[model samples]
Target: MCYIYSRLFMFFSLLLLSFSVYLIILDFVYIIEYIFIIFNSVNITYIILIDWMSMMFMSFVLFISSMVIYYSEEYMNGDLNKNRFILMVIMFVISMMLMIISPNLISILLGWDGLGLVSYCLVIYYQNIKSFSAGMLTALSNRVGDVALLMSIAWMMNYGSWNFMFYLDIMKNDWIMELISYLVVLAAMTKSAQIPFSSWLPAAMAAPTPVSSLVHSSTLVTAGVYLLIRFNYAFSSSLMNFLLFISSMTMFMSGLGANFENDLKKIIALSTLSQLGLMMSILSLGAYKLAFFHLLIHALFKALLFMCAGSIIHSLSNCQDIRCMGGLVKQLPLTCTYFNICNWSLCGIPFMSGFYSKDLIVEFMSMNILNIYIYFIFYISIGLTVAYSFRLTYYSLSGDFNFISMNLLKENNIMLLGMSGLIFIVIISGSVFNWLMFDTLIFICLPILMKFMTLLVIMLGMLFGYELSKFNLVYNLLSKNFYSFFFSSMWNIPILSTLGVNYIPVKMGALLMIFDRGWFEFYGGQNLSLLLKKFTLLQLLSLNHLKIYFLMLLIWIIYLLVQI
Candidate 1:
């Protein structure tokens, strides 16, 4: 039965993959046609290749989506909802395609909303309480971002007309362009999990591994970086300064948060936020190609890391807390091996994919002496990444293997295969994908040397982490939830006024205490009554009917007065 189901899943996945490729081909054909029309002095309503950035973005979506579809087949192995998962994954790819190929704001919005909706469904696929809550948080947070984007679109339509090609035409209007650029950056920061709006991503770790793989690595989060690059031409100098400041701040804070996290997934989650901040900073400097290059490399290594972590957790019967894991190298050799490779790449080790991309970003910023401060932040972030990566690696793969309860190590062939493939991709990305972007000598050499220096910091930090583990000082800080404490304190004003009071009432009253206690029946009855009121047609009619009757009576009285 399993074999039959696997075969069916493979068949459907291949079909969708083929369709996505065909769509890419179709988009290229249109691009070529539009280009030909432009050169021939023909009347072209839509601008194709408005800039090389657009073309690069389209190519990125095509390449990443292709990789995602291929990877999903192996990741979703043996799941009953395999078909449904594939469907959403394909829809996500298609929406991304639409976003890059969109000639107008309306088309782009359709793609944006489409991706958002499908992502919500994918996040909640586990259907548990935690998954549902995470999904809700993701939905709410993204909706706020989406509203900003929608407002920008509406503003453009009113002032600049509905034509998407207006961006190219209105490039000279500095003030209006800057205003629009700020609005777009606001949306991008929210979507990319930058500071002040980053809580959703750590919560989103409740999602399944493949979903996390997709969100962090390739699809949803990439959209924000893509947006910044796409609108690079429209931004003014002041806007760029603002972006650089915010991006740098986000990088520093998120790295600090990652350093204090105990959960392996949340560490990666925070790291992703930091990496996106780096990419945004690059984009702020108008280095679109470099930003996109870093985005591509980060996606490959981060996904590999996440999947490797997932494989370890699965083998240990879903143990995610790094404190519980100790010395798993021998038992899970493949996972440990891949995790080490991915960690090195993530920390920007010399000759690795991350080193090449990250060095380029640093060199791009190094053009100004003041930008060295930004480089300092990047250096600090690199050290922290190495520390956490090695901490995770050492705790899970190098220490004594006494804490784990599970003895039978069931190897997940499909998961391992998927992870191995990503590891292979990361290994070769510097050589193979290097041709995709331009790199200077400084870009090439600086990151390689820095990687070694960063490695030393990692070694020292790991020793510190190990010693602290023995004392268990940091473990308590990690488990007591460092990030959550900061978040609660930051949002304490509203919580104190509303949520705190609500909880206080429950804590004080006997009836409310019973409801808050394990006796769910007390609230269950009230909930049922509310549900009945919501669903009953008579209640709906009374609500709408009363309003309509009032309107009719007002109109009758007006008619009588007019007749008199």
Candidate 2:
């Protein structure tokens, strides 16, 4: 079942990948529209937009899913529910495809809801307490976006159609339309795991590694960024600027969190969160294509990174802690090679797929007349990204062997085969995509020092990474302090988002439950029923009094008759 599914998906992925290239070459868009529903003058339509952008996204999603399933076949070989896992993956991809191909708000909502539902299922795939908690976090966090999308859909009714693509140009001028844009942005923020919504991304790592690769790389997290990209026309300058700040903060937070994170999958998940912030930041600068560019490249390397991580965990008997892993570059050279390359790309090392996107994004941001604070935050975030990447490399791939010496680690054949498919693309896809997507290069004139600043920060970050990863008395002492706690916990975002976002609502729900179960139950149920019972008793007593009066009258009449 796994073999057939994986092979069929691979063939379709390749076919779609090539066809997206074809669509780009031809510069064609094919829209299929059906009148889903109509009322009076409104013609509600179900629309499928086939263009290079959508096609490219579809191909990337399929390619990654194909690889993930192939990897999972080996990774999940012992599991009884491997087929179910594979099917869930297929459902995830289909949900994503529905979002990617549809321009209609309603269709997007259908897809959007599907993503939230299916992701919840995937996250809780493991039958454990942690999985259950993680899945709830994932579901509820995304439910915010679902509500936002639904609101946007409701707001679009004023525009006379659910096909939002046709009305983007007018959304900025009309106040109501501006409201819609804000709603969409809110939805995007939650979906992409921005700020308060960011906690779910790492928590979602409770799922299997293959699902992690797919979710982190393309389907779930990217859904928000893609939505914002499609709705780029609707954003006012203010909303864009707001998104810029939120995304930058998210980038900084996640990068810092990853440096202190020990769990290998969670660290990768945090890094994915960090990259998403970069993507959102670029999009806010009106570089939707560039954001999309970053998104695709990220999807490629991130998937490979997860697959390699899966292989590592599989070899290590399902161990996920980087602290317990070290010097694996020698024992598992091929897997580590893939891991390092993906990490380097993630770090935006030159000639890497990530370099093409990050370098361009940074340069583009530099050219703009932005506030110094935004600039500082952006560059600092970039530096932090490098720092964490190096820190992760230091712990996971280098240093002395930290694991049990008896364990013999070897790569799985199917895992290697799956990973190999994405390796070539991760290396070369950036240049190819940059060439195809941007026909004419963007001209940027920045000073040399600023141009070199990115590299400088990279070096500094690497040095800091070394210092940070070093184990010593002072380091150990500091590790016990508040700073470590703050950074490691993603500024306590998970706690705040879960307890914080839920604090008021959960309290309100409890309050409401009190009303429902305590006051309401008393008044609406028990008390009312008790009062009715008393009223029935009173009526029965009145009848008894009448019967006694009648009996007394009958006795008096009998006595009078006997006296006569």
Could you give the C-alpha RMSD of every candidate to the true structure, in order shown?
14.9, 12.4
Please identify model 2 stretches exceeding 4 Å from their true place.
35-45, 502-564
Task: Report clash pairs, candidate 1.
Answer: none
Model 2 lowest lDDT segment of ten: 470-479
TM-score of each: 0.74, 0.89
Give the range where candidate 1 is weakest over 10 consecutive residues by summed lDDT.
Answer: 488-497
Pull out the clashing pairs in model 2: none
Best by lDDT: 2
lDDT of each model, Cα atoms only? 0.69, 0.88
With candidate 2 superimposed using the best TM-score fit, by how many Å does residue 510's alpha carbon deviate from the native? 6.9
| Per-residue alpha-carbon lDDT of candidate 2 for residues 1-564, written as tens digits (9 for 90 to 100) | 877877888888888888888888888889998877889987777789999899889989988888888888888999998889889899999999999998988888778888999999999999899999999999988888888888878878887678888889955699988898899999999999999788999999999999999999999999999999999998899999999999999998998888777899988899899999999999999989999999999999999999988899988888898888989998899999999999889888889999999999999999999999888988888888888888888888887888888896987788899999999999999899899899788888889999988888878888888788886346667879899999999898888877776678877886677556677676787779878877895666676898877887999999999999
**Candidate 1 per-residue C-alpha lDDT over 1-564 given as tens digits, one digit per residue, 9 for 90 to 100:** 323433444454455445435544454334432332454654444433324444444444444444444555655666788878877776876676667666566557767788789888988888999889778877877887788888777677546454445574475465655666777888888778776667677777887776787679867888878877777778877888888888887777777666566788988888898899889888888787778888878887887788787777776777788877877788888888888888888777778889788766665565554555776876676666666676677667776775545466655676666566557778888656566344343433445555455556556656654564565665665647655566323233323433554686766786556646565765577866997899998887788997878888999999999999
lDDT for 286 (candidate 2): 92
